[model samples]
Target: MSTEESPVEREDRWVLNLRGMSVTKITVDFRLMLFLDSDWEVAFDASVDLSYGTAHANPSVLLSPESQGVAGALALFGANVVSAVAFKSGTLRLVFDNGHHLTCSPDPSFEAWQVTGPRRWHFASLPGGDLAVWTGSGASES
Candidate 1:
Protein backbone atom coordinates (compact mmCIF):
# COMPACT_ATOMS: atom_id res chain seq x y z
CA MET A 1 0.00 0.00 0.00
CA SER A 2 1.18 3.50 -0.77
CA THR A 3 1.73 5.87 2.10
CA GLU A 4 -0.49 8.89 1.55
CA GLU A 5 -2.62 11.30 3.55
CA SER A 6 -6.14 12.23 2.57
CA PRO A 7 -7.89 15.51 3.28
CA VAL A 8 -10.38 15.55 6.11
CA GLU A 9 -13.93 15.34 4.87
CA ARG A 10 -16.06 18.31 5.80
CA GLU A 11 -19.59 17.91 7.08
CA ASP A 12 -21.76 19.93 4.77
CA ARG A 13 -25.10 18.92 6.16
CA TRP A 14 -24.51 19.55 9.83
CA VAL A 15 -24.77 23.18 10.91
CA LEU A 16 -24.13 22.79 14.59
CA ASN A 17 -21.97 20.47 16.67
CA LEU A 18 -23.63 19.72 19.99
CA ARG A 19 -22.26 16.27 20.58
CA GLY A 20 -20.96 15.84 24.12
CA MET A 21 -22.31 19.26 25.10
CA SER A 22 -24.77 19.15 27.94
CA VAL A 23 -27.84 21.30 28.18
CA THR A 24 -26.91 23.76 30.88
CA LYS A 25 -29.99 26.00 30.87
CA ILE A 26 -33.52 26.17 29.52
CA THR A 27 -35.75 29.23 29.46
CA VAL A 28 -39.41 28.84 28.59
CA ASP A 29 -41.23 32.12 28.07
CA PHE A 30 -42.46 33.81 24.93
CA ARG A 31 -39.82 31.68 23.22
CA LEU A 32 -37.74 28.59 23.99
CA MET A 33 -34.08 28.85 24.74
CA LEU A 34 -31.81 25.81 25.03
CA PHE A 35 -28.36 26.66 26.26
CA LEU A 36 -25.43 24.36 25.72
CA ASP A 37 -22.31 24.10 27.75
CA SER A 38 -20.02 25.74 25.23
CA ASP A 39 -21.69 29.07 24.68
CA TRP A 40 -24.23 27.59 22.31
CA GLU A 41 -27.86 28.57 22.42
CA VAL A 42 -30.95 27.74 20.44
CA ALA A 43 -34.01 29.96 20.44
CA PHE A 44 -37.28 29.38 18.70
CA ASP A 45 -40.85 30.57 18.79
CA ALA A 46 -42.25 27.86 16.54
CA SER A 47 -43.74 24.52 17.52
CA VAL A 48 -41.43 21.87 18.96
CA ASP A 49 -41.79 18.15 19.57
CA LEU A 50 -40.14 16.06 22.22
CA SER A 51 -40.01 12.32 21.76
CA TYR A 52 -39.02 10.11 24.64
CA GLY A 53 -37.36 7.20 22.97
CA THR A 54 -39.17 4.16 21.54
CA ALA A 55 -41.39 3.48 24.54
CA HIS A 56 -42.79 6.99 24.33
CA ALA A 57 -42.17 8.05 20.79
CA ASN A 58 -45.17 10.30 20.58
CA PRO A 59 -45.16 13.09 23.12
CA SER A 60 -47.10 16.30 23.35
CA VAL A 61 -46.20 18.96 20.83
CA LEU A 62 -45.30 22.35 22.25
CA LEU A 63 -47.37 24.92 20.44
CA SER A 64 -46.73 27.99 22.52
CA PRO A 65 -44.44 29.07 25.32
CA GLU A 66 -47.32 29.02 27.80
CA SER A 67 -48.48 25.49 26.94
CA GLN A 68 -46.69 23.90 29.92
CA GLY A 69 -44.82 21.71 27.48
CA VAL A 70 -41.69 22.94 29.15
CA ALA A 71 -42.00 19.92 31.38
CA GLY A 72 -40.93 17.68 28.56
CA ALA A 73 -37.76 19.62 27.86
CA LEU A 74 -36.98 19.90 31.54
CA ALA A 75 -35.88 16.29 31.44
CA LEU A 76 -33.04 17.36 29.22
CA PHE A 77 -31.50 19.63 31.78
CA GLY A 78 -27.90 18.55 32.32
CA ALA A 79 -28.43 15.90 29.67
CA ASN A 80 -25.66 15.70 27.13
CA VAL A 81 -26.49 15.95 23.49
CA VAL A 82 -25.52 12.90 21.50
CA SER A 83 -26.25 14.42 18.12
CA ALA A 84 -27.55 17.64 16.64
CA VAL A 85 -28.25 18.23 12.99
CA ALA A 86 -29.93 20.77 10.75
CA PHE A 87 -31.19 19.84 7.34
CA LYS A 88 -31.07 22.03 4.27
CA SER A 89 -34.84 22.19 4.40
CA GLY A 90 -34.56 24.23 7.64
CA THR A 91 -35.44 21.36 9.98
CA LEU A 92 -33.58 20.93 13.23
CA ARG A 93 -33.23 17.73 15.26
CA LEU A 94 -31.43 17.12 18.50
CA VAL A 95 -30.85 13.77 20.16
CA PHE A 96 -29.92 13.54 23.80
CA ASP A 97 -27.91 10.83 25.47
CA ASN A 98 -31.00 9.95 27.49
CA GLY A 99 -32.71 8.72 24.36
CA HIS A 100 -34.95 11.73 24.03
CA HIS A 101 -35.29 13.62 20.76
CA LEU A 102 -36.32 17.17 19.98
CA THR A 103 -37.33 18.62 16.63
CA CYS A 104 -38.24 22.02 15.23
CA SER A 105 -39.51 22.78 11.76
CA PRO A 106 -39.43 25.97 9.79
CA ASP A 107 -42.24 28.49 10.18
CA PRO A 108 -43.92 29.94 7.16
CA SER A 109 -44.46 33.42 8.52
CA PHE A 110 -41.91 33.76 11.28
CA GLU A 111 -38.39 32.70 11.88
CA ALA A 112 -38.58 29.13 13.11
CA TRP A 113 -35.29 28.67 14.94
CA GLN A 114 -31.92 30.24 15.53
CA VAL A 115 -28.71 28.64 16.76
CA THR A 116 -25.79 30.75 17.90
CA GLY A 117 -22.50 29.25 18.87
CA PRO A 118 -18.93 30.10 19.64
CA ARG A 119 -16.62 31.87 17.19
CA ARG A 120 -19.51 33.90 15.83
CA TRP A 121 -21.33 31.01 14.20
CA HIS A 122 -24.99 31.71 13.58
CA PHE A 123 -27.61 29.61 11.85
CA ALA A 124 -31.25 30.42 11.52
CA SER A 125 -34.42 29.38 9.76
CA LEU A 126 -35.60 32.24 7.63
CA PRO A 127 -39.17 33.49 7.62
CA GLY A 128 -39.71 32.11 4.14
CA GLY A 129 -38.55 28.60 5.08
CA ASP A 130 -34.91 28.90 4.01
CA LEU A 131 -31.68 28.83 5.99
CA ALA A 132 -29.23 31.61 6.75
CA VAL A 133 -25.93 30.15 7.89
CA TRP A 134 -22.90 32.06 9.05
CA THR A 135 -19.78 30.18 9.87
CA GLY A 136 -16.75 31.41 11.74
CA SER A 137 -15.07 32.17 8.46
CA GLY A 138 -17.90 33.56 6.39
CA ALA A 139 -21.62 33.48 5.68
CA SER A 140 -23.47 31.10 3.39
CA GLU A 141 -27.16 31.11 2.53
CA SER A 142 -29.05 27.95 1.72
Candidate 2:
Protein backbone atom coordinates (compact mmCIF):
# COMPACT_ATOMS: atom_id res chain seq x y z
CA MET A 1 0.00 0.00 0.00
CA SER A 2 1.04 3.60 -0.55
CA THR A 3 0.64 6.70 1.52
CA GLU A 4 -1.19 8.39 -1.33
CA GLU A 5 -3.68 5.56 -1.31
CA SER A 6 -4.25 5.83 2.45
CA PRO A 7 -3.52 8.91 4.43
CA VAL A 8 -3.81 7.09 7.72
CA GLU A 9 -1.13 4.55 6.85
CA ARG A 10 2.59 4.87 7.45
CA GLU A 11 5.36 3.85 5.13
CA ASP A 12 7.73 1.35 6.71
CA ARG A 13 9.37 3.47 9.45
CA TRP A 14 7.91 5.50 12.28
CA VAL A 15 8.75 7.02 15.63
CA LEU A 16 7.09 6.45 18.99
CA ASN A 17 6.95 9.45 21.28
CA LEU A 18 7.46 7.95 24.70
CA ARG A 19 8.95 10.96 26.43
CA GLY A 20 8.16 11.33 30.12
CA MET A 21 7.10 7.72 30.49
CA SER A 22 9.00 5.92 33.23
CA VAL A 23 9.81 2.27 33.40
CA THR A 24 7.43 0.99 36.05
CA LYS A 25 8.19 -2.69 35.87
CA ILE A 26 10.59 -5.15 34.33
CA THR A 27 9.80 -8.78 33.62
CA VAL A 28 12.09 -11.46 32.30
CA ASP A 29 10.84 -14.89 31.38
CA PHE A 30 11.49 -16.26 27.91
CA ARG A 31 11.66 -12.67 26.90
CA LEU A 32 12.30 -9.26 28.46
CA MET A 33 9.31 -7.03 29.02
CA LEU A 34 9.38 -3.42 30.19
CA PHE A 35 6.22 -1.76 31.40
CA LEU A 36 6.06 2.01 31.06
CA ASP A 37 3.91 4.00 33.42
CA SER A 38 0.98 1.59 33.04
CA ASP A 39 0.54 2.80 29.49
CA TRP A 40 3.07 1.01 27.34
CA GLU A 41 4.55 -2.47 27.40
CA VAL A 42 7.61 -3.36 25.35
CA ALA A 43 8.81 -6.93 24.94
CA PHE A 44 12.15 -7.93 23.53
CA ASP A 45 13.01 -11.40 22.34
CA ALA A 46 16.22 -10.66 20.53
CA SER A 47 19.34 -9.16 22.04
CA VAL A 48 19.19 -5.70 23.56
CA ASP A 49 21.99 -3.20 24.18
CA LEU A 50 21.91 -0.97 27.21
CA SER A 51 24.18 2.02 27.74
CA TYR A 52 24.04 3.47 31.19
CA GLY A 53 26.11 5.89 33.30
CA THR A 54 28.20 7.83 30.82
CA ALA A 55 26.78 6.66 27.54
CA HIS A 56 29.50 8.00 25.30
CA ALA A 57 32.42 6.85 27.39
CA ASN A 58 31.19 3.36 28.16
CA PRO A 59 30.35 0.45 25.95
CA SER A 60 26.76 -0.72 25.92
CA VAL A 61 25.90 -3.86 27.86
CA LEU A 62 24.20 -6.67 26.00
CA LEU A 63 21.02 -7.82 27.64
CA SER A 64 20.16 -11.16 26.14
CA PRO A 65 18.97 -13.47 28.90
CA GLU A 66 20.56 -16.39 27.13
CA SER A 67 23.84 -14.57 27.42
CA GLN A 68 25.65 -12.61 30.06
CA GLY A 69 24.97 -8.96 31.13
CA VAL A 70 21.21 -9.34 31.14
CA ALA A 71 21.22 -8.10 34.71
CA GLY A 72 22.36 -4.71 33.51
CA ALA A 73 18.89 -4.08 32.18
CA LEU A 74 17.56 -3.76 35.70
CA ALA A 75 19.09 -0.31 35.90
CA LEU A 76 16.32 0.93 33.65
CA PHE A 77 13.71 0.44 36.31
CA GLY A 78 12.03 3.75 37.18
CA ALA A 79 13.99 5.55 34.47
CA ASN A 80 11.98 7.95 32.38
CA VAL A 81 12.13 7.72 28.62
CA VAL A 82 13.53 10.81 27.00
CA SER A 83 13.06 9.71 23.42
CA ALA A 84 12.00 6.59 21.60
CA VAL A 85 12.29 5.92 17.89
CA ALA A 86 11.54 2.91 15.71
CA PHE A 87 13.37 2.46 12.46
CA LYS A 88 11.99 1.02 9.24
CA SER A 89 14.40 -1.87 9.48
CA GLY A 90 12.88 -2.82 12.84
CA THR A 91 15.14 -1.19 15.38
CA LEU A 92 13.78 0.31 18.59
CA ARG A 93 15.98 2.99 20.14
CA LEU A 94 15.10 4.42 23.51
CA VAL A 95 16.98 7.08 25.47
CA PHE A 96 16.37 7.52 29.16
CA ASP A 97 16.83 10.52 31.37
CA ASN A 98 19.13 8.62 33.70
CA GLY A 99 21.91 8.55 31.12
CA HIS A 100 20.72 5.27 29.73
CA HIS A 101 20.07 4.22 26.18
CA LEU A 102 18.53 0.99 24.96
CA THR A 103 18.46 -0.46 21.48
CA CYS A 104 16.72 -3.59 20.22
CA SER A 105 17.23 -4.86 16.70
CA PRO A 106 15.26 -7.35 14.65
CA ASP A 107 16.30 -10.97 14.36
CA PRO A 108 16.72 -12.54 10.95
CA SER A 109 14.43 -15.49 11.57
CA PHE A 110 12.15 -14.44 14.40
CA GLU A 111 9.95 -11.68 15.66
CA ALA A 112 12.36 -9.64 17.69
CA TRP A 113 10.36 -7.07 19.59
CA GLN A 114 6.95 -5.55 20.10
CA VAL A 115 5.17 -2.75 21.90
CA THR A 116 1.60 -2.33 23.13
CA GLY A 117 0.37 1.04 24.25
CA PRO A 118 -2.69 3.01 25.23
CA ARG A 119 -5.61 3.39 22.83
CA ARG A 120 -4.94 -0.10 21.57
CA TRP A 121 -1.83 0.90 19.68
CA HIS A 122 0.36 -2.09 18.92
CA PHE A 123 3.53 -2.49 16.89
CA ALA A 124 5.82 -5.40 16.28
CA SER A 125 8.92 -6.37 14.39
CA LEU A 126 7.90 -9.28 12.22
CA PRO A 127 10.10 -12.20 11.41
CA GLY A 128 12.57 -11.53 8.57
CA GLY A 129 12.60 -7.81 9.35
CA ASP A 130 9.38 -5.94 8.81
CA LEU A 131 7.01 -3.84 10.82
CA ALA A 132 3.39 -4.45 11.77
CA VAL A 133 1.49 -1.59 13.34
CA TRP A 134 -2.08 -1.03 14.47
CA THR A 135 -3.68 1.89 16.20
CA GLY A 136 -7.04 2.69 17.74
CA SER A 137 -7.74 5.34 15.13
CA GLY A 138 -6.59 6.01 11.61
CA ALA A 139 -5.07 9.28 12.65
CA SER A 140 -2.87 7.64 15.26
CA GLU A 141 -1.63 4.88 12.98
CA SER A 142 0.61 7.36 11.26
> Which candidate leads in TM-score?
1
C-alpha lDDT of candidate 1 relative to the true structure:
0.75
Candidates in order have lDDT scores of 0.75, 0.76
Instruction: Give the Cα error of residue 109 in candidate 1, in Å.
Output: 0.5
lDDT of 2 by residue, 5-86 (tens): 1113336567675778889999888788999974788999889988876666898888985443378888889988887777
lDDT of 2: 0.76
Each prediction's TM-score versus the true structure: 0.82, 0.81
Q: Model 1 — which ten-residue stretch has the worst lDDT?
A: 1-10
RMSDs, each prediction?
5.9, 6.1
Candidate 2 clash pair list: none
Highest-lDDT candidate: 2
